[model samples]
Structures are given as structure tokens and as C-alpha cells.
Target: MTQSADEGFTTRQVHAGSDARAARPRALPIYMTAGFPFDGFDDAAAHFDQGDGFGYTRTGNPTVDAVERKIASLEGGAQALLVASGQAAVTVVLLGLVSAGEHIVCATHIYEGTRGLILDNLARLNIEVDFVDDVNDVAEWESKIRPTTRVLFAESIANARNDLLDIASIARVADGHGIPLVVDNTFATPYLLRPIEHGAAIVVHSASKFLAGQGSVLGGVIIDDGRFDAVRSGALYPHLTGTGRLGGSSLAERHGGLARIAYLRETVAPRLGPTPSPLNAFLVGQGLETLSLRVQRQSENALIVAEWLSTRPEVASVDYVGLPSHPHHALAGRYLARGNGSVFTFTLRGGIDEARSFVEALRVITHMTHLGDVRSLILHPGTTSHVRRTPEEREAHGVLPGTLRLSIGIEDSADLIADLSRGLDASHPPLETVEAVREESGALDVVVAA
Candidate 1:
């Protein structure tokens, strides 16, 4: 059963897609099977012809379906599709919407994987991509939109830089040109900011992160706001409005507001075969129950840590939008009123050598590439996520030699601060050297050692 919008967020997260009258199970039961048995030939024919029941796991599963519905409700979207991974979700949505010779206007700051997907894979397929550096500038976004452009893509809050995209403003720009706005809301989850509510046509998530709070499983979801009218925008999406494998009826005619989801479910996902396991889906569903609690605590911990880092003499800058010093703090407050997200980056005054010492010196924080885990995770983006890009390209995205990205978790603020202090101490020169420098300056009475 689908939950209504009137229900509280936590209530909907717990109750959405749950059937109280059917099995009487408090937890959503995982349908662990490749295929469901048909009662008879008529049932099989109906299931195959009209897509009545779950014919195969590749197409759909009750467990995956429950998670999809839950995420869709949380995101305030008409429908959602669960894929194997976040990359798969992005791939499925773009493939479903665009084709060869088309183009997509994207924000310059985004995940490295997505950047690679657009620049390497999609470009190889003859699809062009133009990146706008300043997403906040309406003119910059509007200027890049060509007639072939079908989508405007950006992250709600970008990964390492903490640049907050003005969702409503960019959505307006997309709306003006009849293009759909697709936002990757992984950093600022639905609890922080629902892109659909801000006029975005579609929302995507790497459910592996905050959605599955423990970072135990990998999953992704694509949510459709149901505002992109394929029939109205038929020129841009001919595949959706035109006839295809679904007999004579078009997807728009068959599913109405749910045309994109129907098309993905019936054709794109199955054909691409990025099937999510039922067990992983069930785990992700369990994670969704505490989404708000975990994210809130993580955000709080992050803000405290960001403040502490700002005061440190060894730190050059903190890239958290929660901090007043950050350039996008005001914009973050406008769009992300719940809390500035936990995942952000900071840089040290010393270069890679200092960064290596800091990362290795941490006691509680885990050195890892993953984010949004229950345990605080940290990594250097220059040599890790952004290694493939040239030095100039890396600098353009703010991946400097001294830069390190941190994903704050639901840990005690004091303990996290102590661990960070330990790392900072290790990264800086010895106290003896500081004392010697103060003595040499003959200002030991006034100058405090680092």
C-alpha cells in the first residue's frame, strides 16, 4: 500500500509500501525468488502481456518494489525505480531520456564517476555534454541549453566542494526551455532537501550512502515528479510518446503521469539488466527507517567539526556549507533548511605530505573512499576519486594536493574532535620547532606556539 503525503516523514518512511492486512508481518517480507509461479496458462499470459504480476526478478521484485515505493514517498515523487547501483540509476535515466546526437547541460561540480560517464562513455556514443561552471547564475545555465539539450543535471549539494545548487532557480531555467531538471540528491537527502518540491522534474540517489545509513549495501533510485509531460514535450521525447514494443499504445498513453517509470520498468531496466538483489533491497529498506535520525546527527556532528577545523592554525580552509565562512552558506540555508549535509571537504596549509600524515594519524576516523557511513570516513580526492583527471582539471574542481574530503557520521562530537585534533597535531611540525621559532623571533611572551 502506498502512503499519502499527509503522513509525517518518519511515519511514511516506516509505513510506506507495507500491507497491514495481507501477511500481518511487521517487517516487509523479502520475496527471494527468481520467478513467481503462475496459477495457469491464462495467468501467465496475462502477466506477460499486460505486466500484471512479477514475471521475473530482473523485471521486478516485491521487496525491491517496497523500497522503491518507500523512496518515492520520501522524495515526493509519483513513482520510483530501484537499480543495482547509483551509476546504474544515472545510466538508466539518461538512456531512457536521451539518444545519440543529443546533448545534456550539466553543472561542472559533480561526482567524478558521473563526470567520467558524461565525458567518456556518453561522448563515445555521440551524445554531447556542455558543463556550466556557475550553476547559480541563471544566464550561464540558459546560455548552454541548445535545441538538442534534453536535461539539465546537477547535484543538490555537490560532493566535496559543498557548493549548493539553487534547485528552484535551475528548475525554472529548465522549465523555461522545456528541459527537465535532474538533480542527484545523494549528499542532501530528502530529509535535507526534496528536489521535486523545488520544481525539479526528476531526483536520483545513490541509496548506498545516507539512505542505507550503515553503508552495508549498494542501491540506487530514480524518482519522477510526474511533471515532464512527454505528450506535451513530444519533440524532445519521441520514444515515450511514440509507439514501440508495447503493442500499439505509447508509454504516455498507457501510463499517463507514470510514463517514465513504466518505460524504465518495462524496457530500459530489464534490457540493461541491472537487477538489485532482494536481500540488499530489504537491508536498504531497514536503513530508510532511521534516515532522518542518522542524517540529522551526522549533520550536527559535521557542523561542530567544521567549526573546530576552521579555528585550527594548520587548516587553510573548510568547504562545509554549514559554516558562515563558506561561500555557499546562505544558499545552503535557503535550500537545505533541515541541516547542511555531513559529506564535505577541507584543505590543509601543507600539501600532499601533510595530508598523508593527517589521514594516517586519525584514530577513530576510517580512511576510506566511501561516504555517509556510521563511522566517520576520510580520503584525499586528488589521488583517489579524481586521479584520472589532469592536474588542471583537478584544480578546476577544487581537488588540490592538500584537499581532503570527510564524511561525518553519527559519532559523539567530542570524540570526533579529539581524533581530528590528533590528526592535526601529527600533520603540523613538532612543538619543539614552534617553540624554537618563537624563541628566535624574541616574541615568546606575545606569540603562542601552534
Candidate 2:
């Protein structure tokens, strides 16, 4: 079925990338080949010169292209590039925009992988990064922005902590400095928020997470709004404004609005060789078909779970943006009206020992680090995801020894609650405490004496 540009999200998800006239394969077919056959020398020459046809899978693949188009449509962006992983997407976008000696200002709270990439990998390449301790503080973000700053990076909804970023405000800060705002929308997904619509220039995703829904594939995408005009922005991206290595003209001149995306696709991603497999791309597309359903159910389940945890005597805190007690609940209400997303963290009163016990006691919830899976998963951020950081650094980002992250799934609410109850009882030993109370009251002691 043909889809209109104005179709609703779910409708677009199902039909946006479909070519009804071409073979009518109801599902998107995987073009799992390293290279495609060329018609002749002329065709090969044309493909090379214009970068039109998919002569090599690394350059492009039909299956991957379909997923890219669907993701672009979903993100409300002009173009999207699918890569091997979320880390690749970050690497390609950064490399595409900046050279060695340039700078990036990023939100402090983000996925540990991305934090490591900026501080370690990008640092090794001479690209400096400054992290904004408070993303909501426009002045703090602005203060970190240097003349060499090419981009402002942040996540739409930060992982585990559920710190909701003020997208429009940050985009404004980026624009004031003539830089682009690049946001990782993996946690929020396009279902909850479209960063482009909120003024972000580039939106990235870890398609392995919520996008794929089933946690069966590793993929990533960078969606360009086609708005960050390098030529106009001036001095921010000399790579784009300068003559291309392929030797015609600058990317800005050649691709205009699509310069950044074109540069990444033709130069960065292909040369770096982080191309996603066509099969993985196909799985991501399949996941997109039910993105709305899974995310909505997961969000609902997370809220229920968060609320339940908040009331428990053993819980020290619940870091869900959906909760009224959360610091970012108002911001969440403003931006994430659809839902607060399923991935969040909550702390236990008994610290790491109880956290471990609670996780070990869970029967229904799997004890794993991965989020956005169909099955509920739990992990200790202090010991696992944030272990590299010092205690001070971890505490600054709200990752305490007692904190346990939960990726709520679409399981029945009652069943999930019951499972959590059992885990909490094991961790806190409420039954034992009650028995002690009864004995102190002489009720259990007298019965035992008789």
C-alpha cells in the first residue's frame, strides 16, 4: 500500500518504505549481498560518479535504505543513515561534522558507551568534549560552548535516570552559537518525542533497543533534519564547506540541505566500514511495525511499577519521569506527553547488598543490562553500567550503590507487580520483621509455649 506524507505515525511505519509496484513482497525483503551486479561499464561509472546505485553494501543496501527511509519519516527528518551500532552513529556524526581540535558540548547524563566515546575515543583524536552538568540550565550549556564547538549533544530522555532534556531550549542555545544540536532519542524513541519537531537538527538512535523492540539486533541511525546549513553556520564545519576529497565541489555546494548526511554516507560511514547488515535492517523494520504498541504498553507498565516501588519502605527513590515525585516530571509532562518511556532507575534503602538480593530474587524479570526488551530486565548501574566512574562522579549523575535500573516490559501489570513483591520481600524480609513484631507482642511466644 502507498502511504501519504501526512499519514499518521503507525500508518507511516507500516507503509512508508513499501514499494507496492515492485514484486509485492508484503514484508520488506532483505538484500543480503556484499555487492550488486552492474549493468555495464557505463552503469558502474555512473554509480561511482553520482553515488546513485548500490554497487556495494557498505555504500548502500536496498533493505537498509528502506529502514532508513522509514526511520527518517518517523523522526520527521530529511534523511537517515543506518550504521552498525549506536556507537557508530555517534562516531560518524561527530567525524562528519568536526575535525581534530574541534569541540563538542554534551549533556552529562547519557549512555555510558557514548560518554566513553567522547572522553576516550574522540579525545584520542584531539576532539575535546565538555559536559553540561545541568542540561536544563541554558547558561551552563552556553558557557561550555567554545568557538570551536561544532555541536551540542544530548539525549531526548536520558537512560536509566529518566532526566528529560529541554530540547527546544537547548536547540535555541545551539542556534545562538550557530551550532547544531544532535540528540540521541533512543530512550524516548520517536513514539514519545520527535526531536526534530522540537528544534533539534540531528536525531540518533540505538535501533537495538526500543526501535527493534525484541532486542534481537544491533543497529543505529542518524537522522538529519537537513537544516544545519554548514555554509551559513560558518567556520563550524570547514570539512563540509571545503572541497570534497572526491574532487568536484564542497559537500555544502553539492548537496545543499543534505550536505551533512551526504558527507557521512559517502565519506565517514563507508570509509569507517560500520555498515549494518541487511538482515539486521530487516529486523529493525519489522520492529517498527509495532513500535507504538510495545512502547505504549511498556510505558504504562513502567509507571505502574515505579508507583508501586515509590510506596515500598525498602525503596529510597524512584527515578521515573512519569512519577509526580521525580524532579523532571514537569518537563516530562511538557515534552513526553505520549509516555515517560520504559527504562528508569530506582534506589533501595539497603544499598548494593539489597539491590543484589532484589535482582537475584526476581523470577519473572530477567537480570540483564539491556533495555527495551519484551521481557522485563534489571541491572545494577553502580556495579555494571557506571563502574568506570568514581563514586563522586557516579553520585553526581545519580547512580548510587543502591540504585537498580529497570527496563519494564509489556507483561501483565498484576503479574509484574507480584513478581516485584516477591523480590522486595526477599530483599527487605518483611515476613521475618512481622514475625519478630508478633513475638515481641507475646502473641507468637504464648502460642509457642502452649
Per-model TM values vs. the true structure: 0.91, 0.91
Predicted structure 1: lDDT:
0.90
Give the distance in Å from residue 223's predicted Cα in candidate 1 to where it truly belongs.
Answer: 0.5
lDDT by residue for model 2 over 1-450, one digit each (tens)? 567888899989976865546577888998988998888899999999888787999999999999999999999999999999988999899888878999999999999999998888989999998988887999999889888999899998886578899999999999888888999999999999999999999999999999998989999999999875765684667777887566678888888988889989998999999989999999999999999999999999999999999998888999999999888899887899889999998988878888888888989999986888989999999999899999999998889988989999999989999998998887888777978877787986787899
Residue-by-residue lDDT tens digits, candidate 1, 105-153: 9999999899889999999989999999986989999999999999899
The alpha-carbon lDDT assigned to residue 148 of candidate 2 equals 90
What stretches of model 1 exceed 4 Å from their correct place?
Answer: 1-23, 431-450
Quote the lDDT for 194 in model 2: 98
Every candidate's CA RMSD: 9.5, 8.8
Worst 10 residues of 1 by lDDT: 441-450
> How high a TM-score does candidate 2 get?
0.91
Please report how far candidate 1 places residue 104 from its true position, in Å. Answer: 0.6
Clashing residue pairs in candidate 1 (N, C-alpha, C atoms within 3 angstroms):
none
